[model samples]
Target: MRPRHPRDVLVGYDGSDNARLALQEAIFIAQTSNARMTVVSVVPDVAATINAVWLAGGDPAQLSREMRIEVAATLEEAIEQIPEDVPVTKVLGQGHAGPVLVEQIDRIGCDLVVVGTRGRGAMRALLLGSVTEYLVRHSSVPVVVVPPPERLRDDLA
Candidate 1:
């Protein structure tokens, strides 16, 4: 059997600390394998945001614009950290994180998918934030789930 070497890598990033760690690991993998890296951030349907903005006495359009700007800024910051030599692309996805990432994995012809887990607890995991779980169960290629660093886990505990 031959060891797998990815030619294209896709990472799920949401600007969280854990996501940053995942991105770092993805970068390392892409660098080692000479793969193109795609960083994706999924923004779910804006209906909830619109409702919240309306309830908060703000213009929904204005809030939506601000959110887009914030998302762009966050992605830009992440992109800046990537080295100059690595071929990279950024994608802004709509809808749920798990489904969107899977779609991107196929669309980008990626052989590996990287995502971060909060490492809150197995019990809690059953209830919320199942992006990593979903990918592990459904990804056709390979999924790498990066948990928070040991120090961060200790601090959270």
Candidate 2:
């Protein structure tokens, strides 16, 4: 039985092929549940670094501006992956990926958070940071992690 309330599905996209698959899954979930979907791309906060560098005689403002533009473009491309029939809101935020996603879930009252996994093996996942793993462990809301398509995996190898 699907919940009847207006579901808010939050998806994290970083312009990766895996992230694009997640967006497609999120759109399907939103369409089926009559939910509103949000596509979020996190831009890591560099203001403190910029400030420190500025105090130390370096200019970081241009770097920050370029980053913001890149993030915006990434978010826009992610949103374009969703079917036009699905309603979605695009958000560009500044922070580390995990915390930023959790915060946005709470801020938007999202019922579920969807993300993508690169399908790394357990050992590899442990050695390298995994955002999907972090969210699965820490998120208050349920999280759906989509694995990459078989063809995509084949292409990678």
Candidate 3:
């Protein structure tokens, strides 16, 4: 049985192909139910060094600026894909992906959180702990994980 009536819905859109698929589902539910929709993009906190070398020659500010600009552009592209009839607020959450998603859901009082995943095997998911798996277990609110398009097609077949 599917759940009915989502009040405030949040979608974690990282501009990935799977995320775009998730956004489509989110838009449908939000539009049909007239629920408030928020599209969230989570960016990892800036790290200047990978090993001994600095990302931008030890310039954290420059690295931060560049990442933000790229992320913003991706966010805008995602926004453009959204229908104007369905209102969606864009939000940029900073931190690790999983925690940022959980935090935004709580801060925005979102009852439903939609996310996208590659839908890897159980062993791989347990070993790597993908964000979808993390959110599914960690989030106090409801989490709906939308798998990649091919996975959905295969499931239908």
For TM-score, the strongest prediction is 1
Identify the candidate with maximal lDDT. 1
- 1-157 in candidate 2: lDDT tens per residue? 9745448899999988888888888888898888889989988889798999899987798778888899999999987777777778888988888988888888888889888877455456433236787799888988888877786454334
1-157 per-residue lDDT for model 1 (tens digits): 9988999889888899889999999999999999989998876668887999899998998877777777777788788888998999999887788999999988889999988877566456433258888898888889887878786575345
TM-scores of the models, in the given order?
0.88, 0.80, 0.81
Q: Between prediction 1 and prediction 2, which has the larger TM-score? A: 1
Provide the lDDT at 44 for model 2: 84
Sorted on TM-score, highest at the top, how do the candidates line up? 1, 3, 2
Q: lDDT (CA) for every model shown? A: 0.84, 0.83, 0.77
lDDT of 3 by residue, 60-88 (tens): 66667777788778778778877887777
Cα distance off (Å), candidate 2, residue 95: 1.0
Off by over 4 Å in 1: 125-128, 155-157
Identify the runs in model 3 with alpha carbons over 4 angstroms from their true place.
1-3, 48-58, 119-129, 151-157
